[model samples]
Target: MSERILALMGPTASGKSSLAERLAERFDGELISVDSVLVYRGLSIGAAKPDYPHHLVHLRDPVDPYTAADFARDAKRCMKEIIARGRRPILVGGSMLYFRALIHGLDDIPSIDPAIRTAIENEAREVGWPALHRELAQVDPASAAQLHPNHSQRICRALEVYRGTGVPLSSWQLGEAISQADQFECIALCTEPRAALHRRIECRLDGMFAEGLIDEVRALMARGDCHSDLPAIRAVGYRQVWAYLQGEVDLPTCREKALVATRQLAKRQLTWLRSWPDLTWMNTDDAGRLIQVDKTAIEPVKTDENNEIAAVEPVWADRIESLMRNF
Candidate 1:
């Protein structure tokens, strides 16, 4: 039999991890996280780190960089091992770029000159990231649209790619990627209604705070090595809480900002999904029922007592099995 993989993608608080765990149990699969934030060792509560065995989580210190390229390499290795063990490899999380690099190979851009990045950093210090974001918009609107004005790292990387190679990062991303569409036999997105998803987002943020998200950020800051500039520190909830700890914002303000940031993150994740090719869309309910959504309608996945492991679950296995058949 050929190697077949399952990719479960979704926006934040969409119950992806829970659903993935169920699917893994039913399908003889191992879990591999696609989250950028969860790759860091200390990002638990804020990252919404799952309480199950998942490969590629906590693989690095927050201060160290973990690029999409790094994830692609690591994930492929993990998938190969899992398949060799006669189990399925289930890729799950919201990090679209990592998914993209895994399903479609990364572009091999020429080595970037260190001086180009230094120059970009110098320019950013003088005029702030938003200003540089404006510049990026002028030259590479496709990349700029996906990035927030304050997302300094990506903004700088896009500009550096443009300056060094005279090619937009977005353009380079499309160049000659060896597609792994065949290996990723099933790519399903778990989503819900906008209002429902937003409500869940609010609850998720509140729960994180209640679970000592601030204290987690405080401890990371106490490490003295971790700071706002690090990607791990700059992750969604952590970034806002860190600012609050730095006296840049009050607690309420930090909560507000974190909520907004998470919503924006969800929007971007959905945006990526909407345009994705060969995607199977699955909308989930609060009870984690697997519902099929079409371009024109929402169709509930049929389930019965014999199929369900719990409340409307084994239908997920059936639905995913159906999706795999199509490939």
Candidate 2:
């Protein structure tokens, strides 16, 4: 078998980092974080960044842009460096687009000018993203067809590519150049019952509020460069906290909105995981222990009417260790 690149992916507050740390230590692996927001500095508390060292965290200033392409390039380089030091590469985080870009490759689209992007954003602010998405539908119906009307970032990028290169984003996508899929030896998804996951999410959000997540955002705002439009500032918890700081909402309302947004984020993450190919599902309990599950068994357990998962026999550490040992 080819060398393995083990991946641990899950939704926010899913205990991925703790598990990745343990596995990395056990397997002599180096972790490369796959989170989009964790790349920026000053995003630590709200991003739920782990204290344990992981490549790709805190690498960029909050005001700077980091895209999936940048992540793919940096992650591949980090993997090579770790391998050169005779360590295993383990990817960990919930950023599905980064995973997809690394595993399946991205389109060889021309770089859109900053001015074009700025103009698009300006227009979005004026007429709203749905209006711009409608404009995109007129220009590149294929790309527009796949994007949600509210997916402003993607809509902007698709329109920018169309305007900058005079070719539709979907057309450029046809020339996608590389894939690292064959190198993956294991792709594990950490999940639990929907109710269990929601409980985890709520508990984590409350903890973040207690842990000065708002203060962390204030520190970023104090920099005077970070703004609502920046990706780092636009992150889940940070965005809601920023709104509260801006006096647009009360603390209680902000908390409620943040919790709802987080749950929605988790839902989207699970939606991506469900359609994901070659995933080994792992169920995590309240105590944060992991047990491997059959992929066929995951869907039914998640949709159970009671929102409670029946106890399944746990193979836990030994099974996982054996699987990686075989790899």
Most accurate candidate by TM-score:
1
lDDT by residue for model 1 (142-260), tens: 99988889889999999999999999989878733334566675444444457788888898899999999999999999998887889998899999999999999999999999999
Question: lDDT per residue, candidate 2, 1-327, as tens digits?
Answer: 256678888888777787788778777888999999999987887888888899999999988899888998999899888888988888999998788777767776766789999999899889999999999999999788766687788899899999999999877754343335756644444455577778888988999999999999889888897889788887899999999999999999999999998998887777667656666656666555543332222221232354333544444454456555654
Error of 2 at 103 (Å): 1.4
Runs of candidate 1 with Cα error greater than 4 angstroms are 175-179, 186-191, 286-317, 322-327
Against the correct fold, how does model 2 do in TM-score?
0.84
* Clashes within 3 Å, all models in order: 0, 0
